[model samples]
Target chain A: MAEPVLSIRDLRKSFGALKATDGVSLDLRPGEIHALIGPNGAGKTTLIHQIAGGITPDSGEVVFLGEDIGALGVAARARRGLGRSFQISSLAPEFSALRNVMLAVQSRQGSSFRFFRPVMKDRSLTEPAMAMLERTGLAARANVPAAELSHGERRQLEIAIALALGPRAFLLDEPMAGMGPEGSRALTAFLDGLRHEAPILLVEHDMDAVFALADRISVLVYGRVIATGTVDEVRGDAEVRRAYLGERP
Target chain B: MSRERAINLLLAGLLLSVPLAALALGELFYITLATRMAILALAAVGLNFALGLGGLVSFGHAAFFGIGGYVAGIFSSHAFNQTPLFSWPFEFFGSDQMPAIWLAAMLISALIALPIGAISLRTAGVYFIMITLAFAQMIYYFAISWPAYGGEDGLSIVVRNGFPGVNTAVPLIFFLVCYVLLLAALALFALVRDSRFGAALQAGRQNETRLAAVGIAPFRIRLAAFTISAAITGLAGALLADLNRFVSPSMLSWQMSGELIVLIILGGTGRLFGPVAGAMLFVLFEFVLGGLTERWQFFLGLILLGVVLFARGGLIGVLAGKARHG
Candidate 1:
């Protein structure tokens, strides 16, 4: 019922002759997890990149919070509250988990040009960063370098960093990719509560988590969304089953 | 406190004490050698900002060094001849004043660094290194063929530049001034490292995509870092020209740039006093081995190979062990 926080209209991208993203359109609303599921190489990540300002669509409009943000750079888009987590854990490998979150917190606070004043003692940064780490249950490993963090912990760190941005919308590409069963259960529960903070445009493969968490499901195949509806409606759609879920005998 | 911090204090103390001991014994030559070490270390400290912290392997730092040297040489030369450097810009009379010369050197080097960094930063990895090296080589050749400033023969100042209320002509006093400046630069480096800008700059180095995703542009942070690095190295260059009372095209040479990088690697790449340690060891090798035989660089080469292969973290890493937080 609420106006969408993020809308991608008729996005298209081509790598040589093959269209990676061909006429894809989607929207994420105020407080919903709009899950985008597809077979491998279905241009799901490509579609995500297009919206996150990494790849430019040949012809499309990306509207965020009522403004056409197609022309903005990646940092500019992010500053406008478009939080994202990479498919492969993207982090400053040498920095401690706390420092990585502090960077995001620092960005939210203001200019990073504040030289001469030491950041380590700045409670303004450390406090918020510590809170995010705590929220992600990463408090104990706050001092560990991102490189040393376990794969699952790094995923949680990514989510913590995204949370630190105070995002209006989340572009989380495969948040549960390398997660174990226990970790996935914990994260699915965490993400279940996170949707109220910001609507998520989630690209994921774990159908069980998707079915459990998604308020709306969009089945994408060959860079085109075949269906978009409530989870029950999409699951019942014949074309989605044929293209992605496969037919029952 | 931390062992690294304690080791840092001891290094600073060592730098200070050795020069004072030389001053006490009237070993004026040793004082001069120490001054050279301090100046070279200061230059390497400047490079470390871009190279160590920012992960920019710039091989064209000698351009900034030469620009600073030329600034000192030109200003003092114009002052010595009692002539205006340019009458067009409202009769600009150059200065033999050390502080003013240092300002000019830093400004000029930073100015040159801006365009070079702007262009070079568009590329990454080996391309960045080669483009920077190419720029320095161009300047080196420009300095050689240009006839106005003595061409390849180089320019010489009649006397050492003057500092306020101090006899800079005195070897110990000159060394003391350089030593104080070196300490000041080190303090500033520490301060910047702990700042928010440093966090973003280091983030850019470690992972640019992550930096961008966090709403920070890596290009601007790196450019600002590269410019500041040049400014610091420029100050050291001016000090060096004053120390030797000469400025030559060799300051712009690729070999000089390589030597600056060597100084950082030999000490400890990113450690606070890495440059100081490296410079001290390098000077010791040159002095000790030069006294023994003419082929000191051959032995130096062997040692450098060992450092690169086994001592991956450089001299400070070997002594202090690995950094805890990375």
Candidate 2:
């Protein structure tokens, strides 16, 4: 019933002939996990990109924090409190985990133009960065570079980075991709608690995590949302079962 | 201690000691050669801020270097001639003072870098490299065609600029002045490398999209790095002109830009001591090889080829171990 923190309306994108995202509309409210699941090449990532300002929608509006952010760039949107993570694990591989998180913390604090003081020695930056790392269970690996982190740890670090941004809403694109069962379970529990802090527009293929964590689910098929409902309602929907949840439901 | 730290300390020691040894041994010419290495190292250090850290491979840095040289040439020329640079506004007099000239050089170079970096940072990869090179060439050709300051023949100063309490005209004193400045620039480089700005700049270099996701604009960070880098390189250029008592369009040439990059690559791209090591090696090769034969550059080319093909990390990697970052 709360006003949506992020609202995407009639978002459309095309690559020559194929409409990657056609007339897609979605809303993410506070304290809710809105999972967007679809089969391969269903334009889930394209829709997420439009919302995160990575791609310009042919005709649509992405309203964030009561402002039409369709014209903003990725950094501008991020500064305005929209957090995102890549399915392919986008991180500064050369930087230590703590430093990577510290970058996000620095962005939140104030201007990063302060050049004279050594960031490594600054307790204000390091303490908050360490706290984020601790929250992600990567406290011990804080000194390790992102490139040296395990796949699971890198995913966790991504969440830690996003959390440091103090985002009003999170547009997480497949955060649990390439994780094992144990990692997925752990991350699912973490996401369950994370939803209380900010709503998540999760685009994931891991149905177990999605079914367990999503307060509401939206089935995207061929650049369109075929169904949006609770776990039981979406499970019983014939179109979702035929198009996506086929034999499982 | 780590091998990298050990090698870095050894390099600092060698650069400092060798010059002092030359001065003590009355090898005045060797002092001059050492001074050349310091000045060249300083220039490469400036480029390293943008190229190594920010991943901005600027091929037009010679514009900053030449601008610094011209500042020295123009200011000292006016002072020597007892002529006001201009009487229209408020009668601006020229200065032979090193501090004033260094300030002018840095300010002018930063001003130039602002517009150039603003335009160049809009592109990335090879396009960024070519656009910066093209801008440098524009400045180079401009300096050549404009005949007021001697054009292709270049401007020459009768005496080197003055430094407070130091007889800069003396070879040893002048070398000392340059050495001190090089050390200061090296300190600045180290400070920036560990700063928050440096973190964002390096992150931008590694993954621009990720940097943007964290709410830091890659273009702004890179432009700041580029402008600061140009200012440092410009200061080195002024020192170089003062050392030679000459300034020419050649200082602005594309070859000069290539040489600056060579110094960084030959040493180690992102390593702190990389520029110093590369500059020393380069000057030593030029001196030793030139004494042997006129076609010494052919052998230098061969050595550079070997380093590029076999030792991708340059002399620093071979001696100091792997760079902190790939």
Which residue pairs does candidate 2 place in steric collision?
none
> What is the docking quality class of candidate 1?
medium
Write candidate 1's Cα lDDT for B1-326 as tens digits. Answer: 88778888888888778778987888778888999999999998999899977889999999999999999999999999888999994887789999999999999999999999999999999999999999999999999999889899999988999999999999888988998899988898888888999899888888999999999988888999999999999999999999999999999999999999999999998678889999988988999999999999999899999999999889899989975542
Give every prediction's interface RMSD.
1.3, 2.2
Candidate 1 local lDDT, A1-249, one digit each (tens): 778999989999999898888898888999999999999999999998888899988998999999999999899899999999999999999899999999999999979887788887999999999999999999999999999999999999999999999999999999999898999999999999999999999999999899999999998898888999999999999898888887863
Q: Once superposed on the true structure, which residue ranges of model 1 sit more than 4 Å away at CA?
A: none
Give per-residue lDDT, candidate 2, residue A232.
86
Cα lDDT computed for each candidate against the true fold = 0.92, 0.91
Angstrom error of the Cα, residue B231, model 1: value is 0.2
DockQ, model 2, C-alpha based: 0.65
Candidate with the greatest lDDT versus the true structure: 1
DockQ list for all candidates: 0.75, 0.65
lDDT of 2 by residue, B1-326 (tens): 87987887888778777768987898878988988999999999999999988989999999999999999999999999998989987887789999999999999999999999999999999999999999999999999998978899999988899999989988878877888888888889888888889988999989999999989988889999999999999999999999989999999999999999988989988878889999999999999999999998899889889999999888988987765631
Error of 1 at B53 (Å): 0.9
Per-residue lDDT of B197 in model 2: 91
